[model samples]
Target chain A: MRTIRFLLQKEFRQIFRNRAILLLIGVMPVMQLLILPLAANYEVKNINLSVVDHDRSAYAQKLITKVTASGYFKLRGYSASFKEELRKIESDESDLILEIPQGFERNLIREDQQQLFIAVNAINGVKANLGGAYLTSIIRNFNEEIRIELLPPGRFNPAPVIEITASNWYNPLMEYRFYMVPGILAILVTMIGGFLSALNIVKEKEFGTIEQINVTPIKKHHFILGKLIPFWVLGNVVFSLGLLVAWLIYGIIPVGSLLVLYCFLSVYLLAILGFGLLISTFCDTQQQAMFIMFFFMMVFILMGGLFTSIDSMPDWAKLVSRFNPVSYLIEVMRMVILKGSGWKEIWPQFGIIALFAVFLNTYAIINYKKTS
Target chain B: MENLYAIELRNITKTYGREKQVAVDAVSFHVNKGELFGLIGPDGAGKTSIFRILTTLLLAEQGEAWVEGLEVKKDYREIRKIVGYMPGKFSLYPDLTVAENLDFFATVFDTTVAENYELIKEIYVQIEPFKTRRAGKLSGGMKQKLALCCALIHKPRVLFLDEPTTGVDPVSRKEFWEMLKKLKMQGISIIVSTPYMDEASLCDRIALIQHGRILSVDTPENMTGNYPGQLYAVKADQMYLLLKSLRKYPEVLDCYAFGAHAHVSFKNAFEAAPLKAYLRGEGLSEIEMKPIPASIEDYFIKLLKT
Candidate 1:
């Protein structure tokens, strides 16, 4: 225990001494939480659109008015020809283009056939698909209105249509902030625990002091435990600060007991820190340790379910996500915050986190060599 | 009866990897209690490997070793308790303050600065003003002093220093040796490794190692005395041309550029005066030639020859 205390004290002293590292570990999360949600939203709004109405008829104008009124698409420019409007969109001046064919009203009323064209840039395929779907739905709804107007005035007709109700369970609006803030907090905590501790051990190796420690009477368990404690505490502190920002800015709060959340976070932090120590054992230089860690973090954050739902991913990707501790923590955080879940609802996630903590720490201890 | 030896290595050999490259060969030597022992060799000569093995940071295969009467393999845990090791590189945590580094290392051995205050007081007092200073921010000399302090905090029975004076300025190197001498008086057996041949004189005895093998172990005075051959330093106005022309003589055995003079050895039957005349005939002026005492480098070169 004394050895653990000494190692922890040494780690804290070292962390406090490096100003750049302290800023990275402490202030980075808060800044990310405050500014990132504003830019990360997925809901497409106010999409600038261009129109080329070869037929300047009343019917064509009505379609334009309907699209503009829906708020998803705004008419930013009107071109005389299809080529001119295509040029605008190609130059990134507009996101979508609408073309109304010539004699469209004559065809629709006399011949009973009408056609229009909608073109959307597919560079960001998701946004383009959503925009295309939304425009098509508006056009279909307008056509149905005309059909309703044409129905017999005296005859009473009633037909049954199935309704989905389309209710979103925990987050009614699926607001991006509610999903992102908690996950981002999880990433920040994991980084503080893993990256910081890995750098600490590598720094000692570079400085030659680790060699000195090897020739001492200090026990190995004490040394390893000591190195982990400071980062573990610091990880929790950052986690809470992030929680505070989530509450104040996004009104996100846990319905579950604070104790349970901290307990799980602590175990998860231990697993991350142990993984860092294992990485440290394999690296002889700080730059090497940092590079390897950056690679692992990339994998974790991408597979961590921060941006995409794990359930929606392919089977192989979902299986990979099961091994990701950050994914579980994010799930638990969302459950507690949005679902107000307790131990029974989140126990599976907690068990996996505990297993990760024990497994990674044991791996670190076993791999660490007393001699080089 | 105990042999009064501070360290004893019996056929110590260390092999690394599957193919087994011998870093330290079947080498054996001992340091008398309170004596300053030097391991002299160039890079890749396995000096650092030997020191690391003695310090308990590595295990040497194929032999037995003892430090302060404890076997290295069986008693490494106890060996760690009684040794102060300063590795070849400056390994102290650069982020921690000087005081913090000292305290951290002292705490590791379950000892306090006050407990061994007398042991490190002289060295610590020099850098005491910089106690709050971060170790990385200090000068090379100050860093070495702090490293020494951390190593000595536990008041170990022996000190293992691997090239501690390398890359240090000449003046600091002298000061460091002086500090080592003072510690030696307090009966701390010190084993230091260096490639500097000049430092051999500072040790009570030195083992000249090459290619992981011990060439010779003796006092510096006797090693120089044992150098076989007559050596002469010769200089001319045009020294470069003179060296080229002089080596052409069949009587010359070896001619190497020593500072300000070329140390030339002769064939067994060669005469110095005739050689001097031969050089004078070659139109070299301001010629000065004289026999001089052999240096450690000369001794080592002779050993290599044999």
Candidate 2:
């Protein structure tokens, strides 16, 4: 414990002394919380749309009016030919295009069926799929209105009937802040473990003070544990500070136990620190450590189920996320803060994190050596 | 009085890598208690490797070492408590203030600065003006003093410094050795390693190491005294050509340039006046010839040649 205190003091002194590290730890969280949410949104708005009209009839005009009235698509431009419209789609100047066939009013009256063409960009597979679905729904509503208005006496039942209402939960308003803040919190908390610990050991290696520690009476585990405590405590402080800001700036209140969130956070922090210590043992330079940390940071954050729902991922991808500690922590944070979950509800996730903590820490301690 | 032997090694050998590059061969030497011992060698002579093994930071592949009567491997923890190690480079928390660094090291050994306050007071007082300054911000000499103070904070029975004055100015190097002398007076066993030949005289005994092997181990005075050949200092108007010309002489055993003069040894008994006359005949003018006492460097070169 004395060794731990010594190492803790050493690490804290280093972190506090480096202004750049301090800024990364304290100010970065708020900046990410504010900027990333506004920029990284799943619900795409302000979609630009182009229209090509061949019939130029009242029916085609009414169809365009209905598409514009729905407010899902903004008519940004009008094209004279299908060539021009297709060119617009190819160039990505517009997200979607609407086309009306010639004699559309005559066809609807004579054959009781008319075809409307819609083209959309599919690069962002999810957004494209959603846009296609929304466009179909708008056309379906217009067809139903035409049926009720044009054919009053005849009971043909031409307009196919099916109703589906989409609902969003947790963040029913679909605010990006609600989706992003918890995930960024998880990332920052884990970074505290990996980056700080790796840098600390690498700094010692550079300064040659590691030999001083090695020649001391302190056991290897004592030395490692001492280094872990200060960063662990600092991670928690940052976690709590993030929570405080969420409440004060955005009025986000936890629906679950803060203690459970902290417990999972602590376990995740240890696992990250253990992984970092393991990294430090293998790396000899601070530049190498930073590069390794950057690689792992990219993997963990991307796999944390932050941008896309883990449930929506394929089975293999979802299965892979189980190995990512950040994935478990994100779920635990959301469960505790959003669902107000208790120990019984989150015990399984907490167990995985505990195992990760124990496994990584054991691996780190076993692999770590006092000397090169 | 305490036992004369402060440290002992038996066939200590350490090999690095899976391929086993021998860093320290089957080498053995000991330093008496309170003796200022130096392991003098050039770079890559395995001086730091030896210290690492003795301090228990690294374990040798073969052989044994003991410090203060405790086996290095078996009693490593106890040895750690009784040894102070300052590596070849400045190895302190650069971000921490000088005082914070001192306090941290002292705390690691379960000791307080106040307890060893008297021991480190001399070194620490010099760096006290920069107590609040970060260690990285201090000058090289200041950093050197701070490292020494931290090393002595635990007041260990033995001090292991690995080329502690390598890059410092010459005056600071002189001052550092003077500080080591004061600590020696206080009964600390010191083992310092250096490549500086001038520092050999500062130690009671030194082992000249090369290529993971010991060339010689004796008192500086004794090592210089045992030069096998009669060496003469020779210089002429063209010293380079003079050295080259002397090397071609059948009577000359070894002729190597040292500073402004050439240290020439003869194959058999020869006189200095004849060598001067011989040089004059070989287009040399204003020759200076004299026999002088051998220095440690001369002995080192002779040892290398033999």
Give the native contact fraction of candidate 2. 0.88
Cα shift from native, residue B198, model 1 (Å): 1.6
Residue B229, candidate 1: C-alpha displacement in angstroms: 3.6
Chain B TM, every candidate: 0.94, 0.95
Model 1 TM-score on a 0 to 1 scale: 0.94
TM-score of each: 0.94, 0.94
Residue A77 in candidate 1, Cα distance off native in Å:
3.8
DockQ comparisons of all candidates to the true complex: 0.78, 0.74
Across residues A86-141, which tens digit of lDDT does each residue of candidate 2 receive? Answer: 78778887788888888899999899899989888888787677778888888888
lDDT of 1 by residue, B1-306 (tens): 254688998888988899998889999999999989999989999999898888878888878788998888788998999999998888888878899889888888888888998989999999999999988899999999998999899998899998999999999999999999999998899999999999989999999999888999999999988877778899888878788878898899888778889888887865767887888888887888888889878888778777
DockQ of the two-chain complex in candidate 1 = 0.78
Q: Tell me the lDDT of model 1 at B55.
A: 81
The 10-residue segment with the lowest total lDDT in model 1 chain A: A155-164
